[model samples]
Target: MQRQLIQPYLLVLGIALTLSSCFNEPNYPDTPSADFKGIFKYTIAAGTGVGAAKRDSVVLTIGFKDGDGNLGNDIPVPKADSARYAQNGGWGNYQIRTFRLINKQYVELVQDVNKVLFFPDLTKGKPKGAIEGTIDFRQIFTYGSSFKMYPTKFQIKIRDRSLNESNVVETDTISVPFPN
Candidate 1:
């Protein structure tokens, strides 16, 4: 009777070990070394008259690569808030700046104070691949009664979990009309 009980236990343990061995853990990639890529595309809707709501928008896309898959932050908890954590907190991983072309020169445009930018969580096995993000801006520029669209450009850059800043990329000039 004792031999029978021990035999069943051994069989169960052997099965458990075999099953565990069959599963392999994922190996994540390291940090990226190449420069980040970005592009800016925009649309303009001219305002008819005063107090008319004009629609002006810009669509921005960015691409990145990281071998270690450490591009973004993990989910945040109560114990780990924004203030407590400084570097690599949660938001602002990707930096984007807008500029208006005037007289053959690019001038930086004032940004909205409440605007928030974030990086997607790309943490995965062999993270050394291309990651892309799309950002849209609408009804932010006002033209009052002007029907002409202003030429604009965008400068974008990215950062990794290790606080490494990638090379900056300036997008091609795009004309954006102001909102009335």
Candidate 2:
């Protein structure tokens, strides 16, 4: 009789464990912070351009938050018009760094071209408080590019109007396709 009861209990426990393992959820901060967390979803758009110059684009969606509502820049007109100018463009408070999985390890994607991401003006006449929103990052690549057919992820961080830097968040692994 005791053995029979133990078997039922074990079965129930096993089923519970299995169900929990299948659960997939976004990793976000329980409390507000300079930094936030979330799930990274990626999609690709192909057939952009013609012939050998065909290009592919990768789009990333980042769900994030900020304790203080200062996540972007308010630069006016030409970046050169203002003293706030980022290397290649008018990228504001956010920085994006990409990496790929190589031999079971993460390696940064390095190239001569600049690959930075900028956050738009998020605090335009908005009250300062807990802020939460989604940011999309997109990039276009030519056929046969080094990053065309690789498993990649991104490390992203942001800055507040007060110049407070948020903690960096890394995205999940996603695959982009190359020309056949």
Candidate 3:
């Protein structure tokens, strides 16, 4: 009876140790990195009469990896630090740039507002280690009635809490629907 109990306990212990050893943390570089995963386009209809308009929305997905696992900001920016955050392009950790193809060339579309987005802390409740995941960012564009389909692309990058910027990733040319 004693031998039987000891054998079962030993087997369980051996199994647990084997499983734990298989879950080794990834050893990625401290600097963040990103890659273009995919792009999806959709149309959003709004209004009825003269105010009617069709807006093109694009969701861009990118894969990111960070070694230190410090990829986001969970705390809200205090009022005193608002100016500092704004000076650095808002309080977003991800920066996106839009480009429209014109005359067989890509020209960056400069907007009065910066296209920055904030992501919540991604390492919550997890051990300090490298993290890899995909993030989807959506953008909407509206054009005049005379406009039609337009070819556009985007470049994106991410920044960690340590202010380390990831490698820039660019999406392939995508056709965007415009008002006709």
Best by TM-score: 3
Rank ordering of all candidates by lDDT, starting from the highest: 3, 2, 1
Two-way lDDT contest, 2 vs 3, winner: 3
How far off is residue 74 in model 2, in Å? 2.4
Lowest summed lDDT over 10 consecutive residues: which window, candidate 3? 77-86
Give the alpha carbon lDDT tens digit for every residue of 1-180 in model 1.
999999999999999999999976444344443332444444456556665565545555555555455676554523443433343544365667878877888888767642345544565454354444333322255545555677887777666666666677677677776442
Which of the numbered candidates is closest to the native, going by highest lDDT? 3
lDDT by residue (28-140, candidate 2, tens digit) is 34342433244443444455455545455666566667666656665543455233434324334666777777788989876334343455667688775666777776655
Looking at candidate 2, the ten consecutive residues that score lowest on lDDT are 28-37
Pairs with backbone N, CA or C atoms under 3 Å apart (clashes), candidate 1: 29-67, 29-68, 30-67, 30-68, 141-179, 142-179, 143-178, 143-179
For all candidates in order, the CA lDDT equals 0.58, 0.60, 0.81
Error of 2 at 22 (Å): 36
Compare candidates 2 and 3 on TM-score and give the better one: 3
Point out where model 1 deviates above 4 Å. 1-52, 74-81, 84-91, 113-116, 124-148
What is the number of backbone collisions in each predicted candidate, taken in the order shown?
8, 0, 0
Q: Record all residue pairs in model 2 with backbone atoms less than 3 Å apart, i.e. clashing.
A: none
Candidate 3 — which residues are off by over 4 angstroms? 47-52, 75-91, 177-180
